[model samples]
Target: MTAELKLALIHSPTEPAQEAAKVLRDRYEWVPIEQATMAVALGGDGFLLQTLHGMLDRRRILPVFGMNLGTVGFLMNEWSPDLLENRIERAKTFTVTPLRMEIVTVDGESVSYPAINEVSLLRETRQTAKLEVLVNDRVVMPELVCDGVLVSTPAGSTAYNLSAQGPILPLDSALIALTPISPFRPRRWRGAILPERTRIMFRVLDPVKRPVSAVADQREVRDVATVAVAIDRASSLTLLFDPEHALDDRITMEQFAV
Candidate 1:
């Protein structure tokens, strides 16, 4: 099976990743990314996200197997140069859909980006950002005064959302977390979890005075007036992990971490 599959090697520019890539290249034959059915990524979670984003941008999705060579390899498997083919052959597959974020800037410019992790709206200055939260065009929270807020998919709930005290969602929960950074008003409002199909819209109040910026994973847009986020089910990506250390198991174990 391994011999029949065309594999592409993608690695971060870091020295460790570069060195690992050299060893892997010498041991295995790799085809160009455009011609490969599967990809092997070397680096940490950040690098894996970059590789996934690249595939999404090019509209050429491929199942990716990532090895940890950087810090906090939450999205990567244990690095083992030997038995790579065997590991991939026995790997478990996980499918995750990204969020599509549409932003209308203060200048009336429209832009769109995809976020595999989460979409965040942050205050640009010392002043707290005031936002109106709307779910499916219906007003929920008329005003949310906070340092920032984020919408996270289950695949990303353990990331920034977890840091913001968001609930941990199971891989098949079909739920998304709406977490607040630091709320001044509505002091008791921690956050909420909505269905995956929910459309979340945040309208920045007083955009000129208390400007807010929107970020979709790594991409950022400054001075956003309104931002909309929803799951892009059609653009789902596949990740392959070792059966013993699958992503769902890791996420479940995070809840037990002290």
Candidate 2:
């Protein structure tokens, strides 16, 4: 049944992706994205995230199969122009639930963004940021002086979370990582792993002196006074991968990486 499934071909503007698109277009028939049952994305992890975010914005979720044409294609499969339909038919499927970040600025402006990977709060100036951590409306840490903090989903644990020494979580773990960027007070406190359903909050202790910015994946909001993060099960996304290189398998393998 791939023949019966309408497919949409989306590619990044990079030369390699553009060139590959030309080859795939000549070999297969593709419909508009709005009419497609599934989509094939060409590029690296960044472009793949962009495509997924686009779908979220349009409220048109589609299972996407990504082929790597950029660096660090952690979310993409090996690229090949031949037998794409067969590849898609045989591909393994993984469901990913994104995090929802709600922010309130010092000026009282509120905005929300969805992050497929992580939502990080970073110090906007040289002064260290001071934050109060809360879980389910209960204060956990009254004062945390740090460069910043981030809440990462299992899908994002291997990215910036790992870089900041946060634990890598299995894709099916149903857990989230609360990691501090560079803690100054309670220096020994590292990070925590919480149930996916938990609502995490961070309150800026000194917005006037130690301004902070919050980033939901690539989107950022400045001078945030408070931030809330939680898994948005309603906006779950699906990704397709070759059986031999499935995303869950890749995450498991990362734990053993040198």
Candidate 3:
């Protein structure tokens, strides 16, 4: 009912996605993002994240149904050209709250960015980054001398976190994964799992020498100082998935993937 009434078709810059968009638009009369009840996105995980961010940028929170057309389709569903509307009508929604990264640069300018995946702190140069970990304003690690670190949501634990040898979390779990990038001094520290609402903070021990940057998904803030990260519980995005291939199911299956 609502899926057929008002829907928008958005795609990435890839040739396949553009071609798919043309075919979808030709078959279905979809409206713009501003006037749509739901949006059907084409492309891979990166484009899907972009689409979600675009919606948040406009302060619109419509449901997004993503079709895979990229290398890694971790956050996308299988592409079906037939009965797109019918599939959307039967789709299940999963609400994902992004991590809010508050970054203050060397100039003391504070800015906030929302990450749908994970917020990673990376070394800018050849020098190893010295980072101090804080949880709820309490010091956890006095100094971590290594590449960098990150805080990942259950929705993102399978992405970069898994690649970094971090634990994979179930989608519905009310927890976050704190994983280290590469540790030299503290080789035994395997990171921690905190509650979803915990305020995890990272302070650069010698920011001037180390020069670590924080990335909130793809949005990057360069240079200096403290980075505070936490889930933005006030805001969330609903992603639509086919019943048989839901996000939670995928997350569970990923743990078993060899």
Candidate 4:
């Protein structure tokens, strides 16, 4: 009996990805993207994000293996065709829950989406975004004068959250990072680590004076007057990595190296 393995390949529009696709076609039986148990994503972090979002939009969950074909390969593995089966069989699985963002637009429009990494509320104009932040229905910060604020999952903390000076959380740790970007008021406050189950609410103090936009991964909502974020652990996404290069070790190494 032949070993029946269905594989799906997703690639970025990069030179390396085109070359890698040829190699994949030569080695395995390619299946439709929707019918595969495993997906090989060929791209840098950005493309990986795109693939994840695409899967989520389709309401499908599958383990994804990423190869570096873009600028940053932090979430990707070293691309090699030699040990593909061995790597897949020995891959470690980690489950990550995305944050759900609900935003109410200034025109009374309501939109909601899920974010694999974080949900950010950013100032739309040159003026700073003044917001009132609430956690678990209680006001935590009455007035947050800043360029933006973001709540990131542990898997997403390394992305935009890191650039905003947020802490690097271990993948297994059940916590959320609330980081303020370029804050003007509340000068001493950097950020906070909240329980994974907490719900965060951000209300723009003055929509006309301080216009804000909310983004859930690649999905964007312009002119948002209020936004709420919460981790949806019930529905999760899984990522597969070679056992030796598990996500935990990578996150640990990232801390001490830089």
Q: Best by lDDT, which number?
A: 2
Q: Estimate each model's TM-score.
A: 0.98, 0.98, 0.97, 0.96
Query: Compared with the true structure, what per-residue lDDT tens digits does model 2 show for residues 1-258?
Result: 355799999999999999999999999999999899999999999999999999999999999999999999999999999888889989999999999999999999999999999999999999999999999999999999999999999999999999999999999999999999999998999989999999999999999999999999999999999999999999999999999999899999999999
The better candidate by lDDT, 2 or 3, is: 2
The C-alpha lDDT values of all candidates are 0.95, 0.95, 0.89, 0.89
Q: Candidate 2 versus the native: TM-score?
A: 0.98
After superposition, candidate 2 runs with Cα above 4 Å error: 1-3
Runs of candidate 1 with Cα error greater than 4 angstroms are 1-3
RMSD of 4: 1.4
lDDT: which is higher, 1 or 2? 2
Q: Could you tell me how far off, in angstroms, the CA of residue 253 lies in candidate 3 after the best superposition?
A: 1.1
Write model 4 residue lDDT over 193-213, tens digit each, in one string: 998999999999999988999
For candidate 4, report its TM-score: 0.96
| Model 3 regions lying over 4 Å from their true place | 1-4
Clashing pairs in 3: none
